[model samples]
Target: MTLNRRQAIAATAALFAAARAATPRGAFAQSPTTPEVRKAVLGYIALTDAAPLIIAKEKGIFAKYGLPDVEVSKQASWGATRDNIVLGGERGGIDGAHILSPLPYLIHTGRVTQNNQPVPMVLLARLNTNGQAISVAEKHKPLGARLDASPLRRAMNRESKFAMTFRGGTHDLWIRYWLAAGGIDPDGDVQTIVVPPPQMVANMKVNTMDAFCVGEPWNDQLVNQRIGYSALVTGELWRDHPEKALGMRADWVERHPRATEALTAAVIEAQRWCDADANKPEMCSIIGRRAWFNVPVPDILPRSQGNIDYGDGRRVENFPLRMKFWRDHASYPFPSHDLWFLTEDIRWGVLPSNTDAKALIAQVNREGIWRAAAERAGVPASEMPSGPSRGRETFFDGKVFDPEDPAAYLASLTIKKLAGA
Candidate 1:
């Protein structure tokens, strides 16, 4: 006797409700301290990584934790997500967003948006990890451009342009690192442009860009459309690499602390639901609806189930390191991960060469808030790390990143545009 995905989800929801009802009044369920519950207008792009936010709203997780009026709206692009967050909920915009991991630091430092008017923001938790890829146009297949980007050098020499979602965001960093590792300078070797995730396949159809890096189901959609093939999944570049986060204005969090806790707890629970294998099929169906992604379920389900078809006659079933929402403490906002993002921004000359990485990480990463919410949500104490760092991480290229000495790591990079390096 086996239960289908929908049945499993129903069973899980029932168990969750029963547990809440059985608990004492003051134990697992407690009323929020904030009397006036404001609508939590949150923004998301049409990527599969936006699952936790969508699930929280659709499955009543937000309401369960006191954010009954939460509205998860879809944004047109990462750039739109950034501008709306800067404007905040009062000015016909969002209070927070499912954003690129580096965005909070970029906004806090005033490197992007306005005339250096820093938007003070806080990263409450990481949303998802490692479901992005570097995809090349189908024409490049003849050039033998799989993981070895050396073939791109020829195209770069001929005025080839590449696309990424944001200028100093995760997709940008992934493409830059991949190209640089192949001895090609992203700054000098190719022209890069910003194209939103949903538009990637359409743009490539018209030869808008030679290659691009973005989150799914766009990457998988490229294969379905027969326009391109994934040269490398970002997880192959750096396993379990942090991708997106739950970010909000620092002022908003301060004004509604209890609401903030509720929001974080709901997202954490949503992430847990998204990570469960049994819920993945339904998760894909929910997010693939016309109102959300406007994409078909076939385009979305493959990657969600760890099925990878590179569209070049290559496929891998049950690939272990696909997009992750909660397992491996994926939701924890490690300060070290923030530091790595800042370091990459500096490497690409996106941030000032003299920026103090440690102080900025401490100021912007609200892991304390995440811990409070996790504890309130009854996350096992053993799941939380004893310290801020996730320790040293190694990349597929065999290079190690030690968060303790970011400067040394920066200094050792062979390809960089750091101001005085």
Candidate 2:
């Protein structure tokens, strides 16, 4: 007699537990060649961008690399995820994390939302690029974008409000930059507040926030719910922009050197799996399932499969770099990424004025670790250097960012950083 799905799931969970116990310490369950060496925990929120880690775990990339006991906990938010690692919620302290691109800077300088004691962290690899955007309420439709060249000045006069997760986030940074570029002051012109991504649409429906910036599916969620429209995609803001990364404490890397290399190998392979068009359907189910993403499968499948519903009578398929994670030297963890975030922190006054930006970045980034991982994971090692890198990223205004000369980039800006130099 065949059992039902629930019984099958229970049986699978039991098998996993039994296999785990039966295996000797440091022994991988199935792959005989790769013995289990160690286990590590990572924290991530439920967003499409977290796919690489999720897929990697589901696909047994972790087991392939000898990490039989790996656990990927879906935390509620970025702040909670960060705090979990900093406060040592993970076993034997957190080894690494799936975090924002600017997080390493925030941890180092103690700026932005975390204007406290510095939490030391480092970059291990880049997860993906161009996966976030700004969505505006439909009520503000005829006024162009309130975020464009200071739309808030006139809108605020009309009492419009904006929303994002909180201070020290990608949304806050992008909104501030967009507003300042549009000749508006981020802090003064528009009323901005914090709301969790999951509740963004509900809040907007209740007329709480006029606009919000969040990662995909949520932005897509807003559009689907008819509450908001896309003002900009991160790709439009900065074509192929870097968004998230695999982060860790500098001390954690120092403690377990080999584990870092293996961990990266598994993740890189997982990233490749997610990128494969054939695997998308399976990936969607993995992300949407209760054990993982826990989002509705209907909401999870389309975007995860690259068919996005833009909500405003626009259905876009195959948007170029529609979150091209782990593509074309994406996992290198470039020094330029660090510099850009550091500059933003200074520009936004998240840190005290005149923090040694480059110096602190160098200390946190385990260049040696990244180099080893890249070589092992088949990423081009030559592209990443020991010093500052000169890289140009395309953005919305059809401009390119040359990290070697951020001052020129800043000067060319029509908008200004609120934490001005």
Candidate 3:
């Protein structure tokens, strides 16, 4: 008889218990490597994408790998997450985080750090893909700006505020892409503001923002409070687009290579658990608790299971583009996806045109680490992606981004604030 995913996971858990019993005091269960340290601190923002790290902690997956002192601290904002990451765990900050995918690249390059001081960092794995949406304030409900944002073009101006969590993060990129596709200039057509994920709904409630882009459950919360309605999910902009990541301070990872692998293994296992259909409700409940997100489970569970309530008279069940935590190699950090993000950053003048994206990607992206951790996590060989490069990706507006030719992709875009312009 073929064992299902849950049963296989159960068997893996049994092996972990047996291995722990047989191993010496310092060694990790189900693996030959022993961690150099037993403790590490990680930070997270209160978004559904951060579920993997939370689950890893709540399920004791970290302790299973000999790191019993892993701490998943809550961060007030992405900027706070970056500042703390720069401080490092030894300095009372954190060692790693459930961070924006491009943030590690930006922080590693010193593009967003204090005084442009480069903080070396490493990208271990992608936490999830999709599950983010662009929301319109209820005032714009009559505009009917669905997937196509053209309807709001006339209403938008420099005075109109559009908020995202960070200047160069995934939320910024998604909102920019959506606006640009609709023939609205993101750089000049409106004012783009930065608001924390949890504050999105409250800001919209006070009429401070015309529209915003963020991960759940804020978007859902806004809809629930009847403050705003979703115009489009980020997946609608680009299906299965890369989002948050497991990023660590490079020095920390270097000092504790085995510990890094073990931490990654734990997160990988958690991602697998989060993706299972049977476990989403429990996962949401765990993360939504007062100590974690302080959010209602209803705000999180529906989207986690692929049900999208657009709150604009467009509700869909089992939407194909709902977030993927582990399915389709979502846990693997693909270098090609990073290239697109870098290219988009370049288009918006976040990174210089002369920036060597490939060199930086090679230095920062650690897919090799992901492979080792997945193997240790007991991920089936069939589930492992054949290789990097998810290939050419098409957007909802009919634009194609070929990862191999980033310049060509940039050249195709009509609205852009290219670096040095």
Candidate 4:
């Protein structure tokens, strides 16, 4: 469910032009009004959590602010999402789109497919966090029950197939990392494939894919349909992990300063509105409608409202850190988050051993851009984060993560990395 869709849209629509205009007349600290952003193009994965963008668009947020012609397109993959912004270079055309957190970093460090080409990307704000989950079908319930048992070794030796949206981002990385971290070789343990988000459930039903990692409402849909049960919530692996961000080319930030700030301010407004529990039902309706995820409202309802139904009887309501849209200064883009991805890249051998990887991590993330946006949005200036954003967010369980000491964390784990530190 989403909060205040209409109000947020109207507020956003009015802000861009008003921000540029009224402030010029000493309306705000005698600073000049920012120039209006004419238009924007955003890439999205067509899921429920993308409600903010969909609602803002449907309610005319972009148009309200005089960016009436904002273009929202459905992108094919996370790789495409990055390419359109990074390697597609500085598009003097559209603003940006829904980018996964680790993607821009990977692109910058030449870690994944888009390596070598430096893409200057900054997070406008965090759109949604922690909407993703891994699901195994009802028939696989026995497998799901055994998921956390037996150290996952039995599953690995059985020649099972694991599926995900793509090879580059979180789903792939986590699947590989979890397997390797737990002493299973991803190559020999399980066969994997790239199945689009919409097809995850269908594939599961038909037995085409065994266990799949994907975003909601698909996971919820799989559960609601009794096709699958939850195995591992991402939080089970890494808690309070930053997921998606609104990405723009750094050149875009430099070219249209006012427009970027306006966009940032608008997203923050939308996030605050969406975060409220009261707003979720309506938000879900707006996003679950055909133009968005197109799933029924009920499927999106529980999850968006922080209710977790992992098929059968595993149901949890209001998980403490379950998919925060507006908590933890939820919008701040911390550098340590970037560093951790670099560390993961190094761990996986995706990034070369000798690259000044830390320097590269610093350069690509839009730390400066996010800080300025938070201030303009009236969030505490001191609230802005720096360095690695990963931290010890205690879960409903007693465990905690200190990204500060991943090596120790990794070392202490009973599982071993295939290639050792």
Off by over 4 Å in 2: 1-37, 90-94, 112-115, 146-153, 157-159, 378-390, 398-400, 417-421
> How far does residue 251 in candidate 2 sit from its true spot (Å)?
2.2
The lDDT ranking, best first, is 3, 1, 2, 4
lDDT of 2 by residue, 253-314 (tens): 66666777788778877887777778777877788788876666676666655566655556
What TM-score would candidate 4 get against the native? 0.80
Task: Give candidate 1's error at residue 2 in angstroms.
Answer: 70
TM-score to native of every candidate shown: 0.91, 0.83, 0.93, 0.80
Tell me the whole-model lDDT of each prediction, alpha carbons only: 0.89, 0.70, 0.93, 0.66
* Residue-by-residue lDDT tens digits, candidate 4, 1-421: 5549898898788898777785556345323435355566777886665666776677766664445666777776665675666534335433578766667666554445433666566556667667778777576576544234234455445467778776556676666655655556666566768887787888888888767888788888888888878776666666666677777776767787777776666666667678888888888888877766778999888877778887757778887646777776666666666556555555555555454545775566666666665576677645555444645544322334356665554344343233322
In Å, residue 335's CA in model 1 sits off its true spot by: 0.7
Model 1: per-residue Cα lDDT over 168-205, one tens digit each: 99999999998888888888888888998888999999
Candidate 3 similarity to native, TM-score: 0.93
Query: Which candidate order results from sorting by TM-score in descending order?
Result: 3, 1, 2, 4
lDDT of 3 at 176: 92
Candidate 3 structure quality by residue, lDDT tens digits, 1-421: 9999999999999999998888786544335587888899999999999999999999999999989999999999999999999999999999999999999999999999999999999999999999999999998999999888999987888899999999889999999988988989988989899999999999898899999999999998889888889999988888898999999999999998999999999999999999999998999999999999999999999988888888889898988889999998788999999999999999999999998999999999999999999999998899999988999999998899898899899999999997772
Best by lDDT: 3
